[model samples]
Target: MIDDRILVKNVLAGDMQAFRLLIRQHEKLVAHMIGRLVKKDEEREELCQDVFLRVHEKLGEFSFQSKLSTWIATIAYRYAINHLRKQKIRFADLPDEESFTKHFIEETDPESIVEEGDTDAFVLKLVDELPPQYKTVLTLYHVEGMTYPEICEVTQMPEGTVKNYLFRARNLLKEKVKKYLGKEELL
Candidate 1:
């Protein structure tokens, strides 16, 4: 694996191949974040391109305090959020813990998300209904396999908030899964 510092240095020196390497390394993370937050298929591609464009423009300012991927993720997250705001998409406020837990317990099972053979699609459909913050946090932490601190850095959220979001998001998904599959022992 290439070291981040060397890769960054190479890109800064105007090496187009090195820049492509940077994009290749971090594109999945950017795509995962944008995929979770941006619903429009057409806008997803433009938003991803915009993210890398910004990353290229801002490469010189990166302090390297966090991992390169974490920094790139931050850019993607902010860019997607800004795009949503521009589109007048409203993010719902998080409910209180007690109310949230109660609501989930009483929530009805959703319509079948896919054929019975496709559990992954079912789970993804459940995730798609989540609030954007929950979806972003869940995707960053789980899909991208980022650590809590890395997630916090990417989202600019506090460690406590990140943990709370992750916990609540997971609980929400677990409840949804249990309801869908009628499995009581899922955890």
Candidate 2:
């Protein structure tokens, strides 16, 4: 694994390879964040590329105050959220928070199902049903292995809100699991 500290140093020193190395190291994280936030499937990759491009541009401003992945993830989250907002407006109209709304009806991916078993896949399908705030917190904590403070940094959510969303998201998943197991009585 490439050390982000060293990679950032090399990147700052005008090493293109180090820049690419940084992107390669954090690509999955970027993809996961963009995938959940951006509504349009076709635009996902382009938006991810845009996030990395911005990261490259702002590399010099990185204070190393946080983990490089966390900083990169913050960039990815902002880019995706902005892209989602842009989708709700026309070229003549600039988006504002008031105009932004999440309207995408979450869909379960058939591809998420597996031959061996489907419990894990089903759980993920239910996770997709959560509101973006809930989903974002859940993913940042569970999938990205980020702590509450780290998630707060990435999403600009309060630490309390992060814990609330994580707790709520887990309860929701548990309830869904009960339903899927035909154990409504337990729930």
Candidate 3:
């Protein structure tokens, strides 16, 4: 595997192949992040492409202050938010605090589930159902293991706000999972 820093340096130095390598390395992460935010399959693919395009255009501006992934995620977050705002979608309607808490508790705690399969798929499904803000925080913090500060940098939010969002996002996921599992029991 090529070093990310080296790849970035090459891309900045005008090596087209290096840019391709960087895209190949991070495409899946960008795609998954976009998928969680965009409900429409076609739009999601377009947004994913737009993200890479922006990344290429902005490569020279990267200061190496954060991980390349974090930098790319920041771009994806902003692009996704812009797309939603253009559609006049409000972030407030994403998910409630209670619902997120319930889902997190039910899904994250392995003991809550009786059957063990590929919970990843189910988890992704639930995540996709989350509001953009909540989903972004969950994906950045939990899925990508980004530091709170990194998340703040990516989302362009204050540190405290990032922490609060993460807390709320987890809570909301727990709530959704609990409700989902509860419904399964009834069926």
Top-scoring candidate (TM-score): 1
Writing each residue's lDDT as its tens digit, candidate 1 over 27-114 gives 8998998999999988999999999999999999998898889999999999898898898886555577677666665664555554
Residues 1-187 of candidate 2 have per-residue lDDT tens digits of 9777789989989999998888889999999898876657779989899999999999999988999999999999888778766776322242342222221222333333533477667567677766677778888888999988899999998899789878877776665555445566644
Query: How much lDDT does each candidate structure score?
Result: 0.85, 0.77, 0.77
Q: Model 2 clash pairs?
A: none
Candidate 3 C-alpha lDDT tens digits along 1-187 = 8988789889989999998889888887788677777789899889999999999999889888888998998888788878888888876574455665555555454433435565676677666666677778888887788889888888888988878877766655555655657653422
- After aligning candidate 3 to the native by TM-score, how far in Å is the CA of 10 from where it should be? 1.5
Clashes of 1: 0
Name model 2 segments beyond 4 Å from true.
89-116, 183-187
lDDT of 1 at 174: 83
For each predicted model, how many residue pairs clash, with residues at least 3 apart or on different chains? 0, 0, 17
Model 1: lowest-lDDT 10 consecutive positions: 108-117
Candidate 2 clashes: the total is 0
RMSD of 1: 2.5
